[model samples]
Each structure stands twice: as C-alpha cells, then as structure tokens.
Target: MTPHMNTRRAAALAAVAAMVVVGVQTGTANARPAAPDDGSSASPRTSSPAFSSASARTAAIKSAQTDASSTAGSLGLGGKEKLIARDVIKDAKGTVHTRYERTYAGLPVIGGDLVTHIASNGKLKGVTKATDARISVPSTTAKIKTAAAARKVIWAGSGKPVLAFESVKTGVQKDGTPSRRHIITDATTGKTLHSYEAVETAGVGNSQYSGKVDLSTTASGSGFELTDGDRGGHKTYDLNQGESGTGDLVTDDDNTWGDGTGNDRQTAAVDAHYGAAKTWDFYKTALGRDGIAGDGKAAYSRVHYGDAYVNAFWDDSCFCMTYGDGADNKSALTGLDVAGHEMSHGLTASTANLDYVGESGGLNEATSDIFGTAVEFFADNATDVGDYLIGEKIDINGDGSPLRYMDQPSKDGGSADYWDSSVGDLDVHYSSGVANHFFYLLAEGSGAKTINGVDYDSPTSDGSTVTGIGRDKAIQIWYKALSEYMTSSTDYAAARTATEKAATDLYGADSAELKAVDAAWSGVNVK
Candidate 1:
C-alpha cells in the first residue's frame, strides 16, 4: 500500500546466477493486456533513435529499452532480472519517458514496475519506481499450494521479494458484474501476499439525450448491425435486462437508430454506440490512443444491462463496456461523459493498473472522471453540452443535481474538496474529489466563473489564487502521468510527483505548466 515498496530498499540483492526457472503468472485475458502468442518478451529493439514526432513511437520505445538495459545494474536490478517495455512517450523537446515491467529469474515481479526519464541527449534524468526493493528470494519453490493459499487471509507486503503463486478466481459479484480477482501468496510460506480485483468496471450515447447523432454500424443481412467498422470493428450489444452474457447484437433495417425517447430498445443501443464512437475518437484525436487498450482493438459495449440497474461499468474480463437503465427504465446511463468514464477505466487497467483501494483507488476513479469530462468537452455536442458536472443527465441522485461537482466537489456533500492526513480512509468515490477539485482548479482557476452556462466557484485549501492552464494542457499532463509515470501503487503523493515530472517533460523544466501543476495540487491540499 505504501508507494513503491520504499521500505525494502535496503534488502540485499540476492545472487541470481544459479536461479531456478520458475513458472510465473505473467498474463491472463482477464487481468493483463494481451501478450505475443509466441511466449517471447515484448521488449522494444534498442538500436534506433527516437525522433521528435508522433510516428517515432517505436523509436522512442527502443530508446527507452536501450536506456533501461544500460541502467539496470545502477538501479539495483539483479543479473537475472530483465525489463519489458510497457509504454514510451517522447515530449516535443525529445525527452523520453519509458515505462517498464520487471521479471526476476523469468518470474514476473508483482508491483515491480518503474518509469525512466531520459533527456534528449540520452542522459538518464531520473527513475520513478513502483518499488525500491531489490529482488532477493532464497528459492523459487512454493510450499503452499494455490488452493490452500486461496483460503488464507491476505497479508501486507514487507517489500521483500518472495516466489509467489497467483491464483485467479472468476465469479460474479452481488451487483451482477463479473469478478476476476487475482490472489498472490508467498510460494514458500503459503501466506497470502496480496489480492486485487482485476475487473475495472464502469458508459454511452444516444438518441436519448443527444438528439439525432450519427453512428458507425456494419452492414448486416438486409440490415445494419451496431458495429463500427472504422474503429477496430467496435460493436454494441443489447443485454436485454439480463445480468450476464452478451444478449444480442443491436440491429436495424437501416443505419438510422433510436429516437430521443427510451421507448425503443434500439434507443439505448444508439446512445451506447454513439458514445463509444465519440469516446474512441476523443482518445485518438486528443491523446493519440488508438482505443481502450491502445492496440487499435476496440472494447465492445452493452446497453440495457439489467432491469432498472441504474449504473454503468467497464469489465476488463470481457473487454467490454456495460450500461443500465436508470429509474423506471426511463433514463439510460449512456451519456457521452458516462461512456467516456466507463471506458477510461479500461484504459487505466491496461496502463497504470492502479490498485482499487485507498488513495490509489481514489486516483483510479479520479482518472476516469478527468478523462470522462475531457471526452465530453472534446465532443461538444449541442444537447449535452460539456460541463464540469458528472452524470447531470442521468440524475443518479434522484434530484436534478450531478453525481459530482468538479469545481466544488463538496457540493455533492459526500465528496472531499481537499486532501488531508486521513483522505485515503474515505471511500474512493469521495476521496476522488481531491483530484477532481485539483483538475477543476487547474483547468478553470480558483474562483467564481461560469462555463457553458453552468456557474462554479472553486476554492483552494491554502487560500492561494490559482490561474487556469486550460484543459488541453491539463489533460495532456495527466495522461502522460497515468500512462508513463504511474504504477499500480501510486497514491496522491506519488501522483503529485508523477504529474510534476510529466509537466516538466511535456512543457520543460521551468514551464508555466509545471508551476500550475504544483499550485493546483496545493489547492487540493495534496502537497
């Protein structure tokens, strides 16, 4: 739970020359991103220069790989450890931020990820590590079997390395969402090391709120199916009040779909489909991400999830998005921002994989809110104009109020407007308010204002005035932090560091963006 296992930094690095070959849970369809089919490491080639352009992604990754290989020993990496490049980003000034996953003795080191920052001249600037501990385990043999370890209660990590066994349990939660919980235990002691839920639940469109929108559908048998051919063949499904399994592919004789009312079953599907397209476009157009997983593969969507379910979620297990009908099945949860929120969960899962509890959990949720609001603004649809309010259209609170207020999160009553010593103890939904408030202050400044006809008065915990940096730069800094600098265990403190580094990389060491990032976090009491 502590940021990056720093307490274990003093652990001696074990001699790994004669390390035993161990079977590690490296990838699963439900928990991790897809890997190569040939069981080879996906490390980027290190023989290229990273030019300063969008097409230089491969070169940037390669540059990072080269740096990682050279700096392993200095970073306390064992001889048997190898770094697998997860992502790489190059700033306009040619600074490179490389994200990597570690394997020791060919075993995946859980929570052993780091981001390395390199100057354009190839000098290593610094490294942000998820754990400062060096890998040192006596043996790779497991004394306790997976079945027995599953019954034991979870224990906290001491930042020490141990050969661990991963047990994946798949089932359904009480809320009818699929669960893919990964349980890790000490291989030798049979004590539970850690357990985390992999399902990142949380979107979409419509003819409902968004009047007369266009859709991307594939031609079917004398009809059109809710399949987007342009964006990785993305499709939308109608769950038809069922809690499990994909119900059916929503189709129409013509491409036209849904009325403003939710009376037609296709109405909800239309909204979901439209929202998915817009969200996809937002990521691609604004952030350069191809899709939810950034592999140019689209995660599908499910609408009308259950009878009056009143919610929405993103399931990494199915690589899909699900939405429910609100009260009386009259309101669908498929707003543009809602769709963006659900899919961003998948984006987070595929990238940072932020832990879904404590301060890290709050960060995970706030990430969705930030990107969800960005998507809404990016779309700029007339009917559902972009605003700082979350879920204003769906009305989850039974009042005409939003589920969250970014400018003043405390307006929702349950959310925190600022961080404190015990902010992590709050529910993630409310603790997220800290970051939400920070984002609002960063994007719109700390003061009274009106945007898109909605009034807001954002306050600062330190009573200091903050100037706006505009949402465009604010979002870029966040996405960089989330994708290249953050890890599974990042908290608010680590988050501030990550964003500062991100800002420096994006705008330079002394840029206004960097200063604004600091002031905004201070306004939220994160510093």
Candidate 2:
C-alpha cells in the first residue's frame, strides 16, 4: 500500500478530482496525529498590528507572576474540580475562564463575579462582574448562493497554497469538459506545458481540480463526476479495487476516490465543497492568515479513503487529507466537525508543530478537535448546526453521542477532559482533556449550568468562582500560547506555562484576561 493506504479496506485516489475508493485490506497501527511532521507552520504569524502594546509588557509580566503565585494552588483540588481550574488567568476583558475542565475546544460561556481584585503586584483589570453567563446561540442561518454560472468564475484566480505546476495536453469528455488528453495550463505562468491521455474507465471527465473525469459509476451508470479546476486541480487517486485487490497488486498504487455521503455522492461533494470553503474563510477572516500554512498552501482531501475506514487523517509525505465512508454497521465519518478536525491537523502541522507521539501527540489531536469545533461555530450551517458537540450529525457510534465533547470530554467513549500527571501518556483523544478542560473553564466558568437543555456541572479547585469570557477570547489566547510559548514534550504543566504567558502577553497580568485565565484553570483542577 502507498503511504496514504495505511491498513484500511480501501484507499483513495485524487488524480484530478477526488473520485472513488477502491476496496483493499490492511493491518492496524497506533493512532497518531495525522499532521505532517514537517515545516514549522506553528511559528507565530508576522505579528501585525495584531500584536501591539509593548508599553504594558513589563507590567503584565510582573502582575502575571504575582497572580500565578497567589491565586493558584490555594484551592485543594481533585478529579473534576482540579480539571476545571487547570490554568485560569485574568485579563482586561474580564476573567476569561478556561472552558474545558478536562475537555478541549469546547464552547465558551463568559460571565462571572469579582471584576477586579488586588493581586500582589497590583489590581487585575477586566475581572467579571457577575458569575452567570449564558450561551450566545446564533439565530442566523442564511444560505448564500455558491454555485457559479461558469466553472472559471468559481475557480479562476483563486487563492490557495500551490508551490509548482506544469501543463499537459489532455482531452475533453463527451460532456464538453477537458479529459486527460486535454491541454493543461500552468497556474503561475499561464503557459501550456504538455498533452496526455485520460485514464479510460469509461466516462471519467475533467474537473477544475481533477479536470473532467469519471473514475467509476453506479451499476446504473449515473453518479458524481469530477469538476475541472477543483482545489486548483487535485483529487484523491486510488490504483485498485474490488476482486481486483491482490497481494502484489493491492500493495501497488491502486488508489481510487469516493465521497463520504453513503446515500448520494453529490451530497458529499456539496458538503465537502462548502465545508472547505467555510473553513478557509474562517481562518482567513478571523485569524488574518493566508491559509493553513499562513502561506496560501492548498491541500487535497479524499473521502471514502478505504472501505469502512471509520476514520479521517492527514499525512506529511503527501500533504493530503483522507476520510472513510463507513462499514455496513456504521455510518460515514465525514461531518462538519470531522472535516474541521482533520483540517486542524494541517494547522497544527504549520504551527507549534507539536510532536504526534505521546502526551504532546494528545495535545496535537485535541487542538485539532478543539479548533474543529470552533470552525463549526464559525460556519453556522443549518443542516449542520453549530454546537459544543462533535460528530453530532455523523452518528458514527449509533449512540446519539458525539465523537467528543468539549464541556465534558469523558462523555464520549475514549476522551479525558482533566489532566493527571499520567494523562499525557494516554491516547491523544484522552490526553486532549487538559486543554479541553482549560478552554471550558476559561470560557464558561465553574459550577452547574444548563445549555440547550443539556445538564453540566463545572467545578473548581478552590471553592471560589470562575467566569466566562466566551470562546472568541479563549481561542485567541490559546492560539497565541500554542504558536508562541508551547514546544514539544509539553505536558499539562507546560500547557499552563504556555497559556499563562499567552494570557499575560495578550491581555496583561493585571488585566481581566489574566484573572480569568487563573480562574479557568482552577475550575479544571489544573491548579
């Protein structure tokens, strides 16, 4: 099997457009972070006007150190309480409690008591005035017209990270689209490079990405085909399939392509197209970066990677994204959160570039899941509504439970929301709890609350109250911490170090941001 074909029943092929999945077989390996272990994309962005306030630098530091020494560890914590208060801090915006007591990337709820209290160094600003905050559920679900009149209108002069290109003379299909034999143009130079023949499987046409092509069809011969000029011309490519899967041949480059929508391939296509577009927009607009790599780098994703693959991942060598349809017993693994999570692997690769082996690996995975949830909120799709719940739409386990939960990571089968010294050694899914809990406590505060009819009880190490600053502020602090302060081998303690630094840097030690950070960590039992 190719590097992309790790131990799944089928593998994907994106010759020009992600097409179909060819059935195969394989061995299982330890679950690892699906990000490329290359190119330090995690380095902080160019620090535009985004990173100003050098004047308050020293004051913030001294205040942060004093708050760290005074507020944390004063509360004796264990279990859920410890998890809730993991790394709380305060800042000018008020106390921004870490959201997850043990979960990562959970929704944020902001509002708390004690706006400003005198720290050893001085009084922190932006402290919460009340301890109660509610979820800001958005009521907007307006759909926009995305289908363009012309193919080029949707794809021409688009922005994505494409390093190099060459042209080939390919052919046009009966559908009036370019085939493999049609002439290709270089994206950068607008020059013709070469001519080639289309791989004949009958009706495969060209797409904007894969060019005109039909990799396969239903027994009835009506299904989805590639659109020319897809994601700057790329698709999942599989080399073999069905009874055709063999020993020497199976291990060969027999990659095909398939969509994740079990019922209709077109549905999957629409979702993928929309999901990618929304994700790209979120990062570009909210964070002010080019793309995943902050350099306009574009990556291709292949759904239905292997038969019943049941998982999604990213690989470094290929710089590709892959997902599975499902087993007869299971459902497709492609949900908005799943898509967001997988893409986050790409983001993690470019920044902090955390190791994907053990504890750090768990942090890496949680980061993807965390950011993935946030991206869902950013999209606000109706069919795929935004919530703290992950995999709400994709019933992968058939239990009505999502793949992971930000408010309570443990609600899922194999997630941990709190951090013990040993948590970093657990599965990445579980290890993610530390950060998850941190975010939860930071955004929502500690104690009992009801959201969307779901019952939750956020606890803190000290009996004192933590406040919520919402997910928006929490995410920014975490992003800054990850990109600026975190390094490989960082465990729960290290995360505290990083996030505290971030809170102080972004808001100020004496700012409400720092106080919230301190309280949030305390709620997660991080103290």
Quote each prediction's TM-score. 0.65, 0.56
Q: Estimate, for each residue in 303-390, the C-alpha lDDT of model 2 and write its tens digit.
A: 4344554555555445555555545413445566666676666676566766554566667766776777778778765455556766
Candidate 1 lands at a TM-score of 0.65
Scanning candidate 1 in windows of ten residues, the lowest lDDT window is 15-24
Tell me the whole-model lDDT of each prediction, alpha carbons only: 0.72, 0.48
Model 2 scores what on Cα lDDT? Answer: 0.48
- Residue-level lDDT tens digits of model 1 in 1-527: 11232322112111100000000111222222111100012221121123446567787677667866666877768898888887786543356777888877777777777877778898888887777777667766556666753432212145666777778888864334466778777767766667655553221224887787877665443445777877877888888888778879987764567767878888888778888888999888777676886656688988886677666766665677777787689788888788888888778877787766678767888888898899888888999899999878777777788888899998888789999979888866788889989888888899998889999999999899999788887887888889888987899999999999988877788988789999999999887
